[model samples]
Target chain A: MNLTLKVWRQKNSKSAGKLVDYQVSDISPDMSFLEMFDVLNEQLINKGEEPIVFDHDCREGICGMCSMFINGRPHGPKQGITTCQLHMRSFKDGDTIVVEPWRAAAFPVIKDLATDRSSFDRIIASGGFISVNTGNAQDANALPIPKRQADAAFEAAACIACGACVATCKNASAMLFVSAKISQLALLPQGQPERYRRVQSMVAQMDAEGFGNCTNTRACEAECPKGISLENIARMNRDYYAAKFASEEEV
Target chain B: MSSFGKAFSSSIGKKLVVGITGLFLILFLIVHCFINSLIFLNDGGETFNLGAEFMAGNWPIRAGEIVLFLGLIIHIVQTARLTYENRKARPVKYAAYNGSANSKWYSRSMGLLGTLLLIFLIVHLANFWVVSRFTGIPTHDVNNRENLFAVMVETFQNPWIVLLYVLSMVSLCYHLLHGFASAFQTMGWNHKKYAKLIISVGIWYSIIISVLFAAMPIAIYTGLIN
Candidate 1:
């Protein structure tokens, strides 16, 4: 399938960007979105033109490394799938596709469509973990976690840190991403020791990173490839409130 | 500021303030709607006048009015701050954003809707609140209470004011549609068992309350409630 692409291009982060149109012919319908980009890059190399730049790793969709706001969606017009998982067949022949990088103050553009997502790393470093000593592993049955709680935690853990929640949020809120990280540990026995501190610290870092607040629009949940629930956000809010108002620990 | 104050001043804390005040305003809407509906009794404003008198003269209700205004101020101020920061969060706008694909238009338009509602509130207060409290209503009912019912009838006579009321109620309807369920979520009150229930209740409540408020003016203008 042949298509017209209006992809945003920039020399570097300091420079301004604009949509540069490119025409690709003889594209296979079976090629993933990134694969189509590969074909385009091959053509650009043949012509000695600079190819478009984007982020992608683990093309299988789990890495959350692939970031593209294609045709107004985080993942190229599909639900619950990364851009790498999107196939060319989702579009018709001759369709004009618009590709742009994630827009958020916290996630600055590194180059063309690739962004610096290290802010997420900082938030995780702030908390987003269970403090376990480097020692012998305990018996699996030592901590009996309820199946329901385990399932919920697993669901929260499914977040890939793709930044789609922030990308798609009108407010550029990272609450969904932050909440998922908080909830993944908050629901488990191993996570209880630093549960309150984890939420407080992570949320503080999230705010310090200049991410916006959640307005309960639920766009994050809708655009999430992992289908992270807004319930995680509510859980985080509950934990944060408990930490501030109910926890015996002094600030 | 202390850590305690800082906590409440954070992003989530500011939202908590907005949500709490929004819920308080929602409660105020219920009380306001109920008292306004007394006009439907059509007993020549006797019952409505007494209700208005009680609302005006009662000590506790008078005190509650102060709290309500405080809630309103906090809600507006916090929302303004959130909106400003939210806008700044995305310094560059998307070249192609199909927001409707993932979220409701009204949900994304909360700032616009809230602004319209604020304008409506100012006009509404100028028409009724200021007259009733400070300037005083000129007419009186048989019970010697300020004839607020007569004031309502005269206010609705102006077609422009009626149109403004209807349009404002429309804004209020959309505002509450998102605000109601959003308040619950922000307060960490959402549960799977009741999440859907909360959304449905929000829809009905938004429609019912806005319709009731809007209908009062139309009813008065048409002489249905006189």
Candidate 2:
């Protein structure tokens, strides 16, 4: 297969970027989107040109290492998968793909197709942890978590922090991402001790990062590789307001 | 920040304000729509006139009008600020994209619909509310009511004015379609089983209320009840 690529090229966040077109031939249908990029980069290197830079680590969808907005949609046209998991087969032989980095005030561009996602990391670090040390791994059954609650927590935990939610959101909000993290812990018995502080801290950090608000458009969930539910957002809102009110009562 | 400070300061906090005020305005719409629907009694505007007279004369209802306008003003102001912030959040533009594919067009165009409604409100208030309340208007001969029903009939007589009212209701429909459930969601008012109910009700409420309001002007202009 052959395809044309219009990829965003930039020297750094300080510099302007533009779409620089390239064409590749003899692409295998089974090749992942990144692998196709690899073939393109190999051609660029052979011609003594700078290879396009993009972020990727696990190459599987789980690591959340890959970040690319392909043809407008985050992660790509095929729903519920990361850019690395996207196969060249999803496109026609002569298809033209437009690739760009996630555009958000919080996530600044590093270079071609890569943006600084440390803003997400900061939000997670704010309070996305359970500091309580459960001394030993008792029998998994010892925790006695209700099956439904445990399952809900697991579902919320599936968020990969890929920033696709922000990329897809009209407001560029990280509410889904933050809410998923909050809900993951907020649902569990183990997460109860610091629940109020956790939500308050994380939400404050999220706001301080310059992320926008959630209007509940659900685009993030639609574009999410993990299929994280918007229920997590509602949970976060419930918890955040609860925390705020509790703080007010204390005063 | 204090709790209220945080509510006013942060993105979600500000959204909470919009949601609260939006829900209040939604309630106001239901009440307003109900009163206007009374015109359909076809009682030669007698029933509608009594309802209007009661609404205008009651001190509690008059006080509610103040609260309703306060909520509406807050909603409009906060939403305008949020829209500005949202626009700035994406300083750079997408070179190629389809916004409608992700969400409904009405959901994305709240600002435009809101502005249209604002203009409609000003014109509406200037046309009837000012005359009925501040300025002396012709009173009903039989019961000495404010004759707001007569005011509405005469006001909607112009085809241009009727057209404007109809257009405003169209904007109202789209606005409420997105606003109803959105307000609850922002305020975290949801349940697993109940959210579906809430959203379905919101859609229907938007359609029904807008249709009812829209019908009033169109009905009055066409001599349907006269």
Candidate 3:
């Protein structure tokens, strides 16, 4: 297969960036999008040109690092899949693909197509955990969480902190990401002790990090590799409002 | 507000304000659309004009308008504040890509559309209410009643004015299409079983309001309803 790639290129975070075009030939349809990039890079290196930089640690889609906004849609034309999981078969010969970094002020470009997603980390760190020290870990039967709540918590916990939610969001809001974090902790018996504080802290961090407010678009869930539910966002809203009102009553 | 303090204050407060205010606006749209639909009743403008006059002068309607205004303010302010705060949060993006196509175009463009709707509302009120009340136009019909039909017809006759009205109504529909379900979800109404129901309701509500409202001007323009 032959393809024309218009990839976003930036020297650094402080410099302005633009899409640079490159052409590759003899690509196999089975090659993943990242592998195609590897071919492009190999050619660039052989010609003594700077290899296009992108992020992808595990090509298996587990690491949530393979990010690309291929041909206008994120992760190419496939739905509910990661870039690393996307294969060249999804495209045709003589296709001109336009690739760019996620367009959000929150996610500044580091190089070519790589963004600083540490804001997501900060949101997670804010209160996306159960800090109760069980020392060596609790017995499996210690506290019985209802199967429903446990499952819900697990579902919410599936978020891999991929900034896809932000990148896909028009406002670049991280409400889906933040809500998933809050819902994970707010759903479980083990996460109950600090439920209010957990939502409050995580949401606060999300806001402080410049993520936009959730308009309940559910685009994040649609594009999520893990298929995270927007229900998590609703739960987070309920929890956060409950905590706010409860705290106000205490005052 | 300090970063943490500001965020903490806005998180819950902003959602509540936006939700409540959004619901109020939705209610207003429904009522407004219903009243406007009465023009189709073939009463020769008597019933519709009477209703419009009543709405403009009735104490209850006046009070409702005030409440609607307050809701608009809360909705706009909270949206602006939350948007500003969220912009400050991430400051960066994730490494690998594949997440943009999942969302609706309207969902992402709500802020932009909402701002346009706000501008439209100001123009709408100024043209109809202000002219009727203070600008010294013939308010009453042959029966000494406010001839709202004439006002509406005259107002919608200009191609430019009708164009603006159509554009604004389109913006309003887009805003509501995403916003309706969002308000429901924010209140924890996101059961998978009920998700389709909420989405359908959002679509219907948006369609009804936009079509009904925009139809008034088009109807007048085409002489379908005088």
Fnat: each model in turn: 0.76, 0.56, 0.54
> What is the Å distance of residue A68 in model 2 from its true position?
1.0
Clashes, model 1: 0
**What overall lDDT, based on C-alpha atoms, would model 3 receive against the true structure?**
0.79
Ranking by lDDT: 1, 2, 3
Which candidate model has the greater DockQ, 1 or 3?
1
Minimal lDDT window, size 10, model 1 chain A: A242-251
Once model 2 is optimally superposed onto the true structure by TM-score, how far is the C-alpha of residue B189 displaced, in angstroms?
Answer: 1.9
Alpha-carbon DockQ of candidate 3? 0.41
Runs off by more than 4 Å, candidate 2 = A247-251, B139-141
Candidate 2 lDDT over B75-178, as tens digits, reads 88998899888888888877877566677888878889999999999999999789978886776835766677788888988999999999999999999999
Candidate 2 lDDT over residue span A57-165, tens digit each: 9998899979988898998888889999999999999999999999999999999889999999999898999996668776777678888999999999999999999
DockQ of each: 0.82, 0.65, 0.41
Candidate ranking (DockQ, best to worst): 1, 2, 3
Q: Give one digit per residue, the lDDT tens place, for model 3 in B1-226.
A: 5433443466655676688789888988888888888888756677887777778778988898788888888789888987776655535443333334566677777889999998998999888878776775575676678787788888888988899999999998889988998888877778888999989999998998898898888888888887
> Model 1, B98-165: lDDT tens per residue?
89999999999999999999999999999999999999899998888789999999999999999999
Model 2 DockQ vs. reference? 0.65
Clashing pairs in 2: none
Off by over 4 Å in 1: none
The i-RMS of candidate 3 is 5.0
